[model samples]
Target: MTRPQPRPGIDEIKPYVPGSAVTGFDGPVYKLASNESALGPSPKAMEAYEAAAGKLHIYPDGSARVLREALAARYGLAPELIVCGAGSDEILQLLCKAYLGPGDNIVMSRHGFSVYHILAQGCGASTKFAEEKNLTADVDALLAQVDENTRILFIANPNNPTGTAISGEELARLREGLREDVLLVVDAAYAEYMDWVDYDEGTSLVRAAIGTGAENTVMTRTFSKIYGLGGLRLGWAYCPPSIAEVLNKVRGPFNVSLSAIEAGVAAVSDDEFVDDNRDHNRRERARVTQRLRGLGFEVGDSHGNFVLAKGRGDAPVEDVTALIEFLKTRGVTVRQMGGYFLPDYVRISIGSTEANDVCLNAISEFASQ
Candidate 1:
């Protein structure tokens, strides 16, 4: 039997692996992987989902009008400038498909989101990796890698795993320095968790760029993190009207589900829930970071929902591995950062007071061993 040949680039691509939900143990396990909200979806979002359940047989709104209008009002952007997708990940893929090609290249940092590289490869595009300074996107380093062939620059603000963020000034410098033709794709998936003094989350930056007759900047955001709508796979991108039109052409009609649209609409209007979660994350993130530091681990300055803790340089890999296993036994699950190219580090998402206590106790027990 003869099999059809696939693109050479496709053969070499490795798929993105999300955090696992199932552990071998039968008892309850607290998941700290995937950086999801520990408190779960907003009460209003759940209610919206329940209400939409009865209409499952009917097709969802192909344009996701309700969610788009809600998002526009919340962000102070026009609905025409926004395009909703099944998830922010899907929107990323759509961007690649719409902008990249065989000879084009995408610029990203060394430890940037793995999806950027994967999607670029799938589009048969070359990827140039710049060195990240202190687990943050080095704008200077990234600029050095940009050339005539570079068409897209992907930066995850308040980036995942490391949870580091870039300032608005620094991001502006990078944008101003880039060539006129290059598109700056800012992935603000973890933006909601950030409350830094002067960070912009690239929203105003993108808006400013477009206002100044530069339509090359685009920003993508997700309801998954702050709104607790990860399971619904709802996200949206803010771009120039022309870019949004192009992306909408390639994106699947009805890409977002009916329930997801309802949930997203409700979540955006639930400002109280957003504020409470942000407040909880701010307090708990500090608590978790301090505890980890006390355990002889070096943790990065994190602004997102999670913190990254590193074992001593000389510590055995087995010791770190053992710590993860021990934590699992205590029904606590945090992400092992081997996939993020930081094998010595682990990422723990901030949970409720009780969950945080359980995780901290597990860390102490493992370190004491």
Candidate 2:
């Protein structure tokens, strides 16, 4: 008997492993592993979500018009150029499926989001990883890896695992260096947490792409980070009209649920809540970074709501594992960076003051030992 075989690249695609949430400890767990919001979702969004319960029998608008319009009004973007998705993950996959083929490839920073490789490979395309500089995406390195068959370039602003970001000038240089035919996907999932003077969340680049008629750049944003809507799985992309059309064609007609649409509309409109969340993340991230450095760990300046840290001396991997084990015993959990090729480091999401203290205290005790 003959069995149906998967496509060539499908076999090569390593499944995407998400941040771990499980902890052997049964007590109150501080789950900083997933980088979720510390303060949780907005009250208005929650109210809207609760109200949406009545409409569970109804299907969401195929176009998600209200949510798109709300997003446009909030960001000063064109409604027609916005495409909503289950999450930025779906948007990324859609782009890969649309542009990549058997011989095509995508270029990304070596430590960029791991999902990009899986998505490209799922489309029968290969992935090229360019070397990074100081845990940040390097424009020259990424462009150097691009070949004639490279159809896409993915950059996660304020990249995960490392939590380092490139400046706006650097982003512009990268875009200018890329071929016009190549698509530049800027994943701005953690954009709300970035308050650096030179950093950009990618809206300006998307707008510039529209103004210059380049139409090659796309910026994807998520409610999962700042809005605390990860469970709802809501995200949208600010695309050029042409790319928006393609995504709309490829995405499910009702890709976004009624509850997500309602909650998203309320969440985006809650400017006060977003500002508060940003401020909280900024303060806590800085404090955590300073504390980690004080504890003799090498911590970098992070623009996102997380920090990447490692031991100062030779055996960083062992040090990280020991710290993680200790934190777990204290009911606090963080992430290891092995999947990002940074096994020596650990990625800790900035949480509430109590949670941060728990993690820090655990590390301090471990250090004392």
Candidate 3:
């Protein structure tokens, strides 16, 4: 039986492999694979989510105006420029669908978020990767890769897997030199975890563009990280008015759910909760990196809520694989970075103090062996 053909690049997409969730031997599995919050959502957000249960029969506000307004209050972004989506992932997909096509290409850092590469391929567009210097996005290298075919360029500040970031000045330099025709997307999924004086998550650029009536750049954010709403699939993008209009037309009418909207609105209002999560992540991230280094591992300095643990020993790849197996046996789940081309590294999220201790102790045991 012959079937209708799919798109040219559809088959080439290796679907995203998420971080591991459980350990087979789990009595109490310490999940440090996904970069989720150590402390969960605010009590206010949880109450809002539960309150939404009564309205399940009715449809959500198609525009998500209330949530947009709340986000505007929190971030000082113009409500008209914000477009809510199921997740930043959905917004990214919308960007690809709106701009990508055969012969078009997207450029991103070599170790940037994996979803960018997958999304570009799914849209029948090719992806170009610029080499990273010291596990950080090299602005010049990224710009050098751009040509006539490049339609979009993505930079994940506090990038996934490696958890490294470039200074805002560096980012601005890239934007200043970039072709005005290319859409530059700054994915700030882990922005909430960063407090480095030099980091701005491209907001300054977006604000500057908005002031100049420019529309070639956008910044995307997620509720999944700091808000602990990963399960609810909520995120939004702050775009120039023109880009927002394009996204609104192509996006689902109710891309964000009632519960997600309510929770998100309440979550942003809980400034204390966000601050506490930031504090916990900051403290634990440093401790984890310190402990991993104490174990003789080459741990990278990370701004996000995770650290990349690389084996410093000879045969780093084999050592990392052995470390993974050893940790799994002890009921610890951590992310392997092979998919991101860092086969010798493991990305461990900063979990609760107990969870962090468990993971650190497990690695310590493995190193001792």
- Order of models, best TM-score first: 3, 2, 1
How many backbone collisions does model 3 have? 0
159-239, model 2: which lDDT tens digit per residue? 987888888999988888888899999999988887779987787887888788888999999999889999999999999
**For each predicted model, how many residue pairs clash, with residues at least 3 apart or on different chains?**
1, 0, 0
TM-scores, all models, native as reference: 0.96, 0.97, 0.98
Candidate 1 RMSD to the real structure = 1.4
Q: How big is the positional error of residue 105 in model 3, measured in Å on the Cα after superposition?
A: 0.3
- Taking every candidate in turn, the Cα RMSD to the unseen true structure, in Å, is 1.4, 1.3, 1.1
Off by over 4 Å in 3: none
Better of 1 and 2 by lDDT: 2
Off by over 4 Å in 1: none
- Using TM-score as the measure, the top candidate is 3
Where's the lowest-lDDT run of ten residues in candidate 3? 18-27
